[model samples]
Target chain A: MSAALQDLDARIVRATQGGLPRVPEPYAALAATLGVSEAQLLERFAAMLADRRVRRIGVVPNHYALGYTANGMSVWDVNDAQVDALGRQVGALAFVSHCYRRPRRPPDWPYNLFAMVHARSRDEVEARLGEIRALLGAALRAHDVLYSTRILKKTGLRLS
Target chain B: MDELDRVIINRLQGGFPLCTRPFAAAAAELGTDEATLMARIEALLGDGTLTRFGPLFDAERLGGAFTLCALRVPEADFERVAAQVNAHPEVAHNYERAHEFNMWFVLGTRAPADIARVIAAIEAETGLAVFEFPREAEYFIELRLAA
Candidate 1:
C-alpha cells in the first residue's frame, strides 16, 4: 500500500473504531474530524469496501436484545474432501450467521465445519440444525451444538 | 419496529452512503425525509436493537491477531473461571457454550505472539487447558437479520 493510503486506513480505523457519529451527516462529521473532504473520505471508504478491508458499513444489531437469544455454534464433521462444497451450501442458509472450515483435532475435536445459528429459542435452533443435517446427508459423520450460557465479555475491536 | 423501521433496517443492511448528506441520500431512497430517518436510527440504537452503527474492521488485515479459543470448565468452577478469563483486556468477547469445552471466546491482540501469552495466562489463572481454533479459511461471515 502507498504511504498516503496506509495513513488514511489507519486514521479511518481509529476515528470510526468507536463508532460513526450518530448524526444526520455522520460521514461529514467524521470527515471534518480527520481533516479530509467529505468526498475524499467517502472515496477511501469505497476503496476499502472494494478491497475487503471494511466488511460493511451499517447498523450492527444485538441479536440477544433483538430476541435472537438462542444462538448455537453448530459443528459438523464432514468428509474433508467435500467440506468446501458443503460449507458453501450451509452458509447460503438465511439463519446461518457464520460458516467456516477450521482445522480439526482428532479424538477430542473432530468437527471441522462450523455454522452459527440464532433463533428465539433452543427448540428453534435445533429445528434449524435438523435442516442442516438434511442438507449434509451422508456426508455428515457426527455433529454437535454448543449453546452459549453467558456472555462474559462483549466489545468491538480495540486497536491499541 | 414498524414498517418504516423495517425498511430502514433492510435497506441499511446493504450499506450506508458515503455522500455529504448520507442520511438525506438514504431518506430519499427510502421515501422518507432526512430528519425522520435520523430520528428512527437514533431510536433503534437507543433501544438496543442496533448495537452499533459504523464500519466493521477486519482485525487481521490491520496487522492485528485474533482467534477463537475454548476451555472445558468444570461445572462447579464455571463462574470463577469465567471471571478470571474475563479479566484480561485481550479477550474481546467470551461466551459460555453448552458442551464439555463450554467456555468459548475470541481473543484479539496487537501482535500474533500475544495470543499464546494470553492463553497461557488464562490456563494458569483458571488451571484449564485452552483450545485455540484459528480461522484457516473464511467461507462466509455476514450477520444480517431481517426485521
Candidate 2:
C-alpha cells in the first residue's frame, strides 16, 4: 500500500465486485471516473499485482456447467521432514489447482496440507486420489476427498 | 459492444433461471430467440470458455460458518492429513500455496461452534495445528476475461 495508492487504492480495492471493465482503454475509463490519468490507473493495477496484493486478473468460470461437477478438496498431514518435497509433488499435478500447508494443531485444527482436484466425474476425481496415494506411500494414514454437492457462490475477492 | 457476449455473460452471472424454458427466457431478455441462444450457450460451454451457468449459493446465509484454514503438514503425512480434512462435508475450495503455512481449505459448518469443534476434533485426530483465517469482509474480484 504505497502512499500514492493509499486513498484511491483503498477505494478501488473496496470495489472488487463484478468483472473488471472489458474495454481497450478500460484503465483510462476508470481514471476518468477517478479524476486521474490512464497511466495512473494502470500504474496502480500494475503495482498492486507486483506487490502480490492481487493474485490475477482473469475469468473464473462455473466448473459444474462445464462438466466438472465433481470437485474435491483434499487435505493431508504430512510429516514435517517430507512436507516440502511432497507438497511440491502434489502441487505440480494438473488437477491440483491449489495446494498449501498451514500450522498444525494443538490450539488449532489438524490436517495441515491441502489440495483441490476437479474432474468431470467422481470416478475421475477418485482416480487422481489413487495416484496421490501411490505417490505418498504408507505415510498417508488418513485422507478424505470431499465432493461438492452444490456451489454456494464462487466469486472473486471484493476489491473495492 | 459484443452484443452476444454481453447477453451471455449477463445471463450467466445472475445464474441460469431454473425453468422448463430457461433458454427461452434468456433469449427474450437478449432480444434473441430460444434456439439461437441455446446454440450459442452450448458452444460457449463446449469451448471451455464458460465454466458453469447455475446457482451460486450464499453459504454463510444458509447457516454455515466458513473460515480459511491452513496447516504446516510434513511431507510424509501430506496425503494422510488431506484425507482427514476432506472427511468433513463442509470443506469447500482448498489450495496449496507456496508458503510456510501451505495447506489451505475453506471450512463450513452448520453452526459457528461447529467450526471450532470440528477444527479441534481435527487437531486431536491428526495431532497437528490448523490456522483458521475466517473472512473479515466480503470481497469479490472483478476480473473476467473478454474473449
lDDT of 2: 0.61
CA shift of A46, model 1, Å:
0.9
Which residues of candidate 2, in runs, are more than 4 Å off?
A103-110, A150-160, B1-66, B69-147
Candidate 1 residue lDDT tens string, B13-119: 75788777888898899999999988998999999888778888777777789999988889999889989998999899998877998899999998899999999
DockQ, candidate 2, comes to 0.06
| Candidate 2, A1-160: lDDT as tens digits | 4566688776555443343433334455556777877677667666655554545443346554445666777766667677667777887776776676655554444565667787877898889889888877766656666554433323322122
Steric clash pairs (candidate 1): none
The iRMS of the candidates, in order, is 1.7, 13.1
Clash count for each candidate, listed in order shown? 0, 61
- The weakest ten consecutive residues by lDDT in model 2 chain A span A151-160
lDDT of candidate 2 over B9-122, digit per residue (tens): 544554333233556666687788777876675666566656543323233542356688777878788778777877766676556544455576777666788888888988
The DockQ-based CAPRI class assigned to model 1 is medium
